[model samples]
Target chain A: MSRVAAFVFRRKGGKGWHWTDIVTWVWLVGGLFIMFGPAVWLVGSSLKTPAALAEFPPTILPYVTQKVSVEGFDKPFDLYEVTLDDGSKATLAEVRRIGIVSQMVDPKAPGEIIKVNIAQRTPVREMSFATENYTEPFTHFDFFRYLWNSVFVTVVATLITLVVNSMAAFALSKYEFRGRTAAMLVILATLMVPLSVIMVPLYSIVSALGLFNSLWGVILPTVATPTGVFILRQYMLTIPDELVDAARMDKASEWQIYWRIILPLTAPALAVLAIFSVVWRWNDFLWPLIVLSRKELYTLQVGLSIYSGELNVQWHFILAMTVVTMIPVVLVFIFLQRFITTGIAGTGLK
Target chain B: MTIDGSGKTGPRVGEIAMAPVRFAMGLVDAPLRKLQKVAGLGGMATFFLLPNMLIFGIFVLLPFFINFAYSMTGGSALFLSDRSFVGVDQYARLFDCSNYLDPNSCAEDTFWTAVGNTGWFVVLQVTLMIAFSLVTALILNRDLKARSFWRAMFFFPVLLSPVVVGLIWKWILQRQGLLNFGLYGFGFDPYAWLNDRTWSFAAAVAVSIWAHMGFYTLILLAGLQAIPKDLYEAAEMDGTRSMRVFMRITLPLLMPNLLVVIVLVLIRAVQIFDEVYVLTGGGPGTSTLFLTQYIYETGFATQLRNPGLAAAASILMGVVLVVLTLVQLGLGRSSDKNGGRK
Candidate 1:
């Protein structure tokens, strides 16, 4: 094979390195930071206590101020290094304060309290990962319920979508039938009609059906995706007609032909559709937000939005929940990363 | 089952896993055969097609036509019959601006602002997204180590929910957020990145690019790899500069994929509601409110929703989308015929 272009691969120059490799290295490293840095920082911030989160210049790592209980004090006193008015520094536990002065006591001898201006002391701190940030939401918020609802919607919708779309694709691609052209045309024509366009009417119809605040309400409407049928139909068109004919000759029913012969043959495309469906259903917001108003039925996307969108926002909890909301999709991407490019190119949906 | 011709080696893992599926199909097989005998081949086709058609018709096609009816009627009532027929009054209200260019002069000023914001957003976001995607695609297309890994890093955000994407950026851009914290550490004042109007709008575009550029980059990378190596070799033999060769060969070859990316990004950019909604909440005096959010706020979020007016705005948005779709189909047709527009 001809050598790869110098431009495409790293090439050694007479000196240190080629200019192109340097630029590419810088570009990749810089992109890695810009793309992934915010999220890494977020994980750090989420692991911080609420007070740590509120700091003006927050640390890159989570840290909490140290507190110590002195010999006499029943309550834990915040430990701080304080300078006395006589110009001596000592580690003292904070006792109480009046106005700007903070009353401090040495741990060994807690009888006497020294009053120092707040600015004259620095609080001792230690690095601590706030695991409670991740756990507290489970008890305090509807995060787990939201997660279960999202999982239910995504899994059920994808399964139904696969069955329905594959059946439609099989009919369109494998058989000659009445209204086939019309049916196919109708599906193809509405390919670009996103839910945003017809949301108000769809909402009315869903409400009329008494599916308001229902998970099935979110699942059913999106199952008959035009893109799914289109992709599957295009894939099934490649299968030879003789397979179906042979299956028929073997006395197999039409359903059998569809289930055994065509379905298995169309597995790669199905995998793509399944991946596509999972991501779309998992990440879906607008439709669920419309249909499921009750908080119990709220999907992760809607719940995460409500959490972050609130006034007097709880940053630490929101941060933790946001991390939870995104992890599944990211994990899905990593596992199915190979198939996703094909999924997008096949359907042009995303 | 016999036609599968794979029983020679006994039951494989797939066949074993599918045992229940086969059994279930067997139970239905007799009835289905009887139905096929009664209804013939045409009926079988109909059977296969009906479920999808039923759902597609009810959810997608039916609502689309009903959307027009909703637009034509007036009132907060959702069902078309409950509302009185306004017959284009909603459209008229949308167009009732004294000066269309100045949203302030319009009676429905928020609608105009949303339209204006969507317009600017589509222009800036689509343009920059394409440029950045192309550059990233080119860089990734190079015979570099860990190419797929780098590609995955970019594509990962595309998988994130718009809400998550929004919240991630919201954390960074909020006052006392990480971005501000960094600025403060450098002795700079912590700026309210999301609160300022100009910065908020810019953030909307940037965050949008951040979320979606990976997908387009993947498409363009595929296009880049598809270009024959011989063409580049020929250019090299002719002593052509890389820039000149890219303009002469690479650009033309990648045009079709680039067109698809552009149109998709345009359609998506116009419907920029969720992330920006979470990011700015269309805040700092409505600097970043796009078309979808306006319709959503009008039709649902408000105490008294004006479905008629919202339907009209969405109808207008639909028209724009239809035009974009047609362009894609047209370009897609030509692209298929020649493998590229040229």
Candidate 2:
């Protein structure tokens, strides 16, 4: 073989680190940052104060170099003191109180100041890096209530979908009953029908069923996902027939076979479906937005939109809220990412 | 003679009955003997399909039929009061070449314009997305260390909800955003990425790619893996160049996956609503006004009671999608089954 040909034919595994390998490593590692950089920026900025967040070139780590200065408060008298261990206050008179003007108050204030807009509660005196972005949602607002409501709906919807779809998939896969092909066709063909066509009517149906704004509102419509059933059925078909037959020989019922034998074998496939359902439910914005009207019942995605107005957006708050909201999904993905990648690809094969 | 005939018939009948009993007993020991030879089949089929059937029927089948029915009516809240049967009036009004009654009492040209914009977006976004994903997948699939980690990194963006993706990217592209900050560092002037009409559309498409190309990448990677490595080795032995190998082997083998990805992406891009809704909100004078978002605006966003119009628009969009999806499936199936051989 020619030298070039020999080099090309050489098994890649045995090739010690070469120029190509080094370039590939750089590209791969750099590519990781390219993919995750925006997300990192988003989550990082979320933890920052509005001023720190607006800093040019953007800092990933907390800003320790700059102390934020607040101005424009009418009252400026100062004699700041913190009591030492002796319990006698010795004054350090140079420090003065500065009130940062929140967006809630206008610059053209005084007459425009509404009683409802005032920050009546005492502000935190400490300057420190904290998880207030997360905890504040729990303490200061009904963010937890919204989160609970979202969780309740998503969990219920996903579980119901899994059960119903799995059963359907099982029936379609295993049975040679009448209209079997027709039933499968009906399920598959519906995949093409755009969800927009049914949004209005589905909304009307939910209202008609008296399920609007209730947990049932979210759960009922999403149950029995044809896609899920299709996936589960496809997965179930891969199971060996003899395993099921052995169970039948032991006088075990069909349900017993499903619960004990089939479901266990399908765990890998089910894990994939679980990730899909969780991510989809967690990120679902439109359907939930349509179904839910009450602020307290809003999902994280929907509630986050309230901070996003027609024109003006509070970037700091939105980023903070976004970071907070992404936590559960990120955690879920981290735990189940492997299953997620394998499941869809594997299921798609059938 | 009569007694002889009766004795002969009885003897024949008794022999036949004994034969049948032996056959029945022979079958008794087998597991499925009691089940009419298809024992668990009926029950098991029901278990597999029952859930999907129920859900699909209620959510999918029912909605399809309902939309078909709604398409026939003049279906606005106000029009509901009129209660007049307008056979194909809505679909007609959608394409009525003359001045249809706008609330402003002027000519409203919605169909052609919306169709034009949607067509452009579908063509642009789908092609870009597929090309982007395929290239990325090819690069990633190359013999490299830490392939799994890099794969995960590329695929991570796919995990983000479109809504969240829009919100995050919007921040990045905002006037005082990271983009501007970075530009300022290099002494370059900041540009309006999402605010300008042309740029807004591009920005929307860019966001769609960022949010979803990972999915296509996975699909393409799978396709790449399926290609026989032996083919590449054989080509190399014959002194076939790298580019030639890619063109001849890789591209052709990857066609099936490419078709699927293209079709899926096209259909999805045409119906895109969430990202545009979050990012530009179909702004800068409707430069980024996609058909789905247009329907949304007419129905929900604009606070106008033109749901009838919105419904009409949605049905039209659905028709377009259905046609596209059907064509894709038809072409895709035929190509895979026969194209390579020919």
Candidate 3:
């Protein structure tokens, strides 16, 4: 057996498969499918034609309904080539525009058109991708503007969150001050206060600050997240005091030491916070929904919600927009999956 | 004054005269130096914490008190100056139920309905969330093929925006959606998944689990990986059954994570607004309306836009959440203490 196989099947009974192994593989594969099926369905449905989407038995693959020109018909129609009684192939066309009329044209005879009374035409399921679903939303709505708003908000908010949070974390973790414990406790206590509880007052505060309809309204209030501070603080506490002392011995000011030494040493935790901050700011819906009423200021999440408004829920366009919105976060997750998992696990242990 | 190369050791009369001028400069710097000394190391700490504290004060701490005050008032006004103070009346209205058990008998039927719905949602969501998450974690922790790939697949949805998760599932669970299509292929009748009350609530719960189970799973997976290998090896050596080994060894060892998952899921399930709101719009006769949605609709969505009553409702939620979070923190602390001892 190969080394990996040996390791995998190393459950005391030498290098062989166990029942548990079979069960585990089966469960894992099934779980993977269940977890990913909806997303896959979303992408597939977005690429499907309206007719295919409305089919009784939904098609997983996107299909295009094409019109083919028969020998006798000048205009192209959706027709199926059929093998007649005598083994020669003829084209069957169902023309529904002028009542249900079926026409059969002999391939051998260029101009022979025979009217056939057939109830149903043979169904042809062709795999086709509607790339229009991706472009149609942009054509009709200001999707790019929403995209830009999302990106701008995410970048600015994440940067502010990192700087504010890291500074606080550094002080709490590294320094000895009169109110250090009290400050940490208060910060941790704020974690219990859900945003929903403070929504009304926070809204008023934003309005009072004259940031009501601005993206800054959304950005400012969320820059100093308590959870970000806690996570970074936990990670920062693990760093040795010797590093800070060494920097101080080199005549480095506290600010200089923090800027140069602490930030660099805590790069992994900072990266984790950056990832989370981006995701949170990018995906934030309710606050932005309340704050940003103008079409110009809507974030991607809000824009996607507007796309899925009550009267006309264009699932194709909505799904396409959802897929588009997920691209950046998905990219972030892909690049930093290890860090994210480690960060989460680490926090949990703490 | 000492010269570097030319070794002049003593101060001349001109140097002595300049010393007085320098002393005057020092006199000028006296208060500034004293201020710096007073500020000192603690001053640096204060400086580092000031920006975060300022923002946190304005946004978090201040709003907390403001929300309490708003809850005590009654009006459609956004500004407190325009509102009338009606102490506890909003809470009274929320609590005024002819039959407290029956939400329909309540004065504010929608709020009561939301409360009742959230109660059920939390119970069901947390239970299923823990079960599914634990199972997924356990399965993923095994020495299986493509382990990280499976882990990523499960964790990917957790990274997605709740809106995206809601939209994706909403499309899939619609009347002519993928679920219906699958059923139709098997010669089953199409069900209006989102339009029906029970199915809509169920759909909401299922989607909530789908979106978040990955996160809880990751936590539990960490817990599973932390279990010592020797215990499992000893169990195997004694030819212990797999189920018994899991129940006795794995489950018992994983209590901390399980508790964390439970409390976290409970809190999250209570605060579920984004997914359920987008998916069903608290719809099919308010079946899926949660507490957060109730606060949002009351404060922002309705024509009344009753911020006061919404604030009251939010305060009620805040109280419950605060208690739960305290319990969670306490559990975490106790667990940490225990772990430290071990």
Candidate 4:
């Protein structure tokens, strides 16, 4: 009887084990899908034309092609034959101007239109899958100039930030002066005060200085970021004082010490800070939006917002633009990842 | 370590002997030695700091004073000639200046509402963000395979622009967005995530967490790695369970980092604008209208051009931020002391 009971218990245990193993596998797959699914969709959507994007069910890949329109308008008016009394057929351009629905285009079915109106589907017309979104701007159907400006601003800003921030950090870290603590405290204090607090005043200052609509308008205010100063100073502090003293004793000038001794040693930290600064300045939206009034001066972020405006947000173009904007940041991140982990760990600084 | 003829230990002779005669050099060298001890040894410190000081004064300090002055006067959008010297009246108007057009607009209510909404946003976002990041950090720091890959995956969100974050999440959470599409597929009714009054507020808080978790994770992971391995070994030898070990050892050790992360998160959460702007545009109703957004609309939005009110709002926001920072720093200090004791 005891052996019989033991056998029964063993059988139940085996069944439970089998059940849990199946459940665990299901959960593992489900969790990963949930986490990485959006990233995969973003990449996939960028390759899709408007027709293929976010259609009723998401597609596994972007494989659809769109038809081109070529045979619409040779003569201005075919009115008399068609309408008799009115005799004037509305030209394609005139129809478009008066908000008439296109003849070839289907007026969305009532149910579908309601869903689209409710924000389910973004209704950008499908176009041929060319890289025109990346190149064409004269016709203004897509982005080209805004991307160029973003690249210019990012490269210029990153270079300037590295030099200015490193210099300030070197001074703060190596020197022990009467106002050193006070200066450090002030920088830290700025971290607490958000830019929103002084944005109006900042705008007024920029306007007064006549920097509106210029690249310098965006670049100048951010040159003195408190966060950069904090990061650089902390990294510099970990450098031994003896090195500077030794360099000085050898008759190396302060500038020489900064250029040769200190700069070389802090390369890893500087790289990390550079990545931080570049990514931030490149991706900045608000300040750039306010400073650059001219459409031509808009950076990638602000331009992307304009592309997303309610009247005409071309999802395909927007996604393509997103891909274009993200590529540089992604490449920089991959390059900096090796140094960044150490920097973040606080080990590299010391 | 082989030394060359010049040697690495001391400065080369010419650097020390820039002056003419040996007699004058000796006289100059003695007093200069004392000057070199404190600030940048000798004259080195003064010159290196000169540029930084000038920039800091002009950009940071001078503006700080100006901000205070503007707060005092009823600052206008117009130039100095058009400004008036209404001392403290501007500050008073902050509470009383309701409908600039309507006599009964009740300005004080709007200001107070903004304050309440901002506070709620900070509380919800900071707590949720810290929780998400701490969990991710703990999981990533575990002695598991593919730890590095997971760490990289988790940290990727921080690399994206906040505007991108806002936009991506906006696409997902809009009334008929991916969330509803997914839900519909699963046979549930579609929920409006961005347009509903309550859901809009909640969605903003959620976006702040998703965007910020990576930075906090990095900070916490550093703190986690700093804990010595011996403690864990000892806990195991004493037959303590994993949960007990984490509670007794890891929690105490990680407190300093937690304080840093918390304070930073709080400060950032209060200043959230980019996500708020791109997501709902503070819409449906005033449900998602954050303080910064309110100030932005007042000062810059095409429809609402109230520079004086905006300035007052900004000054008020600044004061609140400063006070909150001070309080957090104090709490952080006490917690740090407790951590040291453990």
Best-matching candidate per DockQ: 1
- Interface DockQ per candidate: 0.50, 0.21, 0.30, 0.23
- Candidate 2 stretches greater than 4 Å from native: A1-30, A57-60, A64-130, A310-313, A348-350, B1-48, B78-84, B97-113, B335-342
TM-score of chain A of each: 0.91, 0.72, 0.86, 0.70
Candidate 3 vs candidate 4: the TM-score winner is: 3
True contacts kept of each: 0.68, 0.44, 0.61, 0.27
Ranking by lDDT: 1, 3, 2, 4
Model number with the top lDDT: 1
Candidate 2 has an interface RMSD (Å) of 17.0
Q: Chain B TM-score of model 2, please?
A: 0.78
lDDT of all predictions:
0.86, 0.67, 0.81, 0.66
Task: Residues A1-350, candidate 2: write the lDDT tens digits.
Answer: 59897787466657665565555667666767767888987877777766566566665565533222224545432222333345554322222234642222222332332222113322223334545666665776677787887788777777667666766766666556899888878877877776666676566556766888876787777776666767777778888888988888998666656655776555555545656787888788777777888888888888776556532544666777778777877886676555566554544421
Question: What C-alpha lDDT, on a 0 to 100 scale, does residue A120 get in candidate 3?
Answer: 40
Q: What is the clash count for each candidate, in the order shown?
A: 0, 14, 0, 10
Candidate 4 clashes between residue pairs 3 or more apart in a chain or in different chains: A79-A87, A79-A88, A79-A89, A80-A87, A249-B11, A250-B11, A250-B12, B36-B41, B36-B42, B98-B107
Q: Which predicted model would earn the best TM-score?
A: 1
lDDT of 4 by residue, B1-342 (tens): 111222221223322322232344345554555555544553566655555556555555555556665665554454434566677776687667445433246545555666777888998888888887887778667654566666766666667776677667766675445677788789877666887989889988987786667678887998898799999999999999877888999998898788778877877777788867877787767778888887887777747476667777888888878887897778777866875886
Candidate 2, residues B235-264, lDDT tens digits: the string is 989999777999999999888778877878
> Candidate 4's residue-wise lDDT over A1-350, tens digit each?
99897675464335543553444345335535544555555666667656566465545566443222323444332111112124432111111222332222222221111101111111233343445544543356435677778888876776667666777788789876788888778777766656778777677777777887998888877777676777767767877999988987898656667756776566555556666677888888888988887888989898877666652346666666666777776786676564555556652121
Q: In DockQ, how does model 1 score against the reference complex? A: 0.50
Model 2 CA lDDT for position B59: 67
> Per-candidate TM vs. native?
0.94, 0.79, 0.89, 0.77
